[model samples]
Target: MSKQFFVTFCLLFITFYGKCQVTCSLPNKKAFETKIDSLNKIDLDSLNPSQKITSIAETFLGEPYMEKTLDIDIKKETVVINFTGFDCTTFVENMIALTKLYTGDQNEKYRTLEHYASILEHIRYRNGKLKGYTSRLHYFTDWVRNNQAKGIVKDITVEIGGQTYDKNIDFMSTHITAYDQLVKNDSAISAIRLIEDDLNQTPLSQIYIKDISKVESKIQSGDIIALVCNVKGLDVAHVGLALRKEDGRIYLLHASQSKGKVVITDKPLAEWLKNSKLNTGITVARLN
Candidate 1:
């Protein structure tokens, strides 16, 4: 089917189901369908959630890194499915969404592109509803916290030797010009400020950089690894899935800004964190 027709179908589906009105963007529709088809053929029954995450994540190994793909529409938000390129957050979110498609009900009705978009919306938006630009889970900690409440994932940072991550999260509101939506939109800025305020009081925890090595053995493959930032007013600087290589050390499988593509870190995650001044620690979560 043509991309236009597919998008129209998605719109009709969403409207018929009383879902939030949103545009769907699938730049590579054939590629997406092929991916879903291939994944559907896999025996996911044998694999655990972590294995399923890594199995799906490896498919985007060399995809180009593209920042701000979600900012396609200034006046409205789009359910964007871009297989061609990804930022760190999109890569991790899509990985979980795809895994959900397979692990969810086996009925054919649950495997359509619209269904995939629903899964993505659930993972990306707060409380699984798309009200506006501010509704997106811009903060990684908030994303984990909300998803954990829905039984999608569990924050395991504290269990693996994490300490309180006490930093005021007002980055987006403070740096308004950096975001186009927040620049001229007073309501968007106000919504973000409120979100930051709530997050600051949410009581977050992270594994400090100095202690990452001590708990490296406990972090499993396919665990979500959020690079906790030392920068002012920010909660997370980067995000990726953990991959325990044959060398028995966990490496970051992420969309690398430096490489301009998706890649596994050349060194172990602990050593990788040492190279960055902005990154102070990590917050780990597991798919439930």
Candidate 2:
């Protein structure tokens, strides 16, 4: 992708209050089409559909987080759609919004760029208390747990290649897109390390999978998983997505905010649970 495209993506989320008018009904499947319709109702008709997808993604970057609504779409599971600055709730919202593209479809499994508009819903909150609003964003874990509870989610697990290990060891109780399992583990970690940890170099992507089996075993076929790690006991860490795998090696893709969107990489089936936790002694959790 071009830097301009990436730049626009970042800005879209940043300029949420700048002049965008959301005019669609909330929570309704029709909201997807109408949300995109409002955008198309704009003067940017010259842009193609892909460009439009990027534009839509960028437009709702930080529209706050609504606990009951999923109104923003995170890029195809490959991208974290996260910057350290982008709080946890927004991640959940993005996931919902992006899914609008694939909602009501049976064959769709991964995030596709084709359904960009269906992902956005026109709505907002009058206050945190939640009253009459078009959107309802769920708390990250609550959202996932609820989805899992409601059957919208199949299960959560760690995966690489064609193999998946779903078991709850230590990290199964929380929700977060692990930096390692996130977009491109090495890339997300490297970029985050540069921006946050101030580290100079990172490992090539080696890991241990003791407890990972517990987590992967439960992950439903279409669910997204996060990977994380740090030193043995310290707290600093990296995160990412374990979208899926090919053959036997788990292939991953993520948006290392610092590195930009959806880049591909690979790792062992359980690259994060080296010593039963994220290899670096980090923590792992599911994303809402």
Candidate 3:
């Protein structure tokens, strides 16, 4: 082959490889289309971002809690969307993605599965690029920081009566055997360790369980709440959306592990946190 032709061929090959890397798994295509059509008909112009989020989140109230739905393949990272079931992180991510989709302009380009995938990829991965398994935001604090940088969210932990949560985060790297991808992968483990090191440098801020009651007034509905864990080497145990109900108190809207489905907690936010011995406090992020 001629030098120029060879170079062009290589470039084309690379482009094809990059485009083929992401495999999207939309389990319920008809449901997805129906939901999208419904969102398109809604008068989102009257609602703010928070209202949009809560409105979107409430639609998935009965979604079964399924762990590791994102782990579509052990070798390849797929943009997996399961409206039928959601883990806590997936529930939060999907709610935010759907709200963004609902609130965005009604251009034909914006109303496609690919556009939704692009939005989800931006929200789920680091700097919105999916390089590999490690590219996924494993840490909730990291997720908040990256999304904040992208103008998707603003970390309101410090603004709402929070204090420094000084601790090292290395749970994933240390517990590599627990993760299928990291069980024998040295490179992935190394990358996670580096991420953990960076996280340790910046102390996270959280509203203590004792102080959450005082700051309940500030936490608005549709705000993302990360349950900061007391567990060693873990920054966040779980995450969900905050909902201020008619009774004038904040409640958690999350994919509950114990309940095996997505549901609003019966108790208020403060009481819920107080009940969990594993949870230390909360890191709040509001959609921007």
- In model 3, the runs with Cα more than 4 Å from the true position are 1-26
* lDDT, residue 191, model 2: 35
All candidates' TM-scores? 0.91, 0.35, 0.90
Model 2, residue 31: what's the lDDT?
A: 38
lDDT tens digits, residues 1-288, model 1? 999988776544122233645444444555678777777677775788999999989988998999997887778775666666799999999899988887855555577777777888889999998888999999898999999988899999999899885678888999999988888899999999899888888787999888998999999999999999888888899999999999999999999999999999999999988877898899999999
Give the better candidate number (1 or 2) by lDDT.
Answer: 1
Shift of residue 8 alpha carbon in model 1, Å: 17
Q: In model 1, what lDDT does residue 12 have?
A: 41
Top candidate (lDDT): 1
Q: What number of backbone clashes does candidate 1 have, counting pairs of residues 3 or more apart or in separate chains?
A: 0
Ordering by lDDT = 1, 3, 2
Pitting candidate 1 against candidate 3, the one with the higher lDDT is 1
Instruction: Report the alpha-carbon TM-score of model 3 versus the true structure.
Output: 0.90
- Candidate 3, residue 44: the lDDT equals 69
Model 3 pairs whose backbones collide:
none
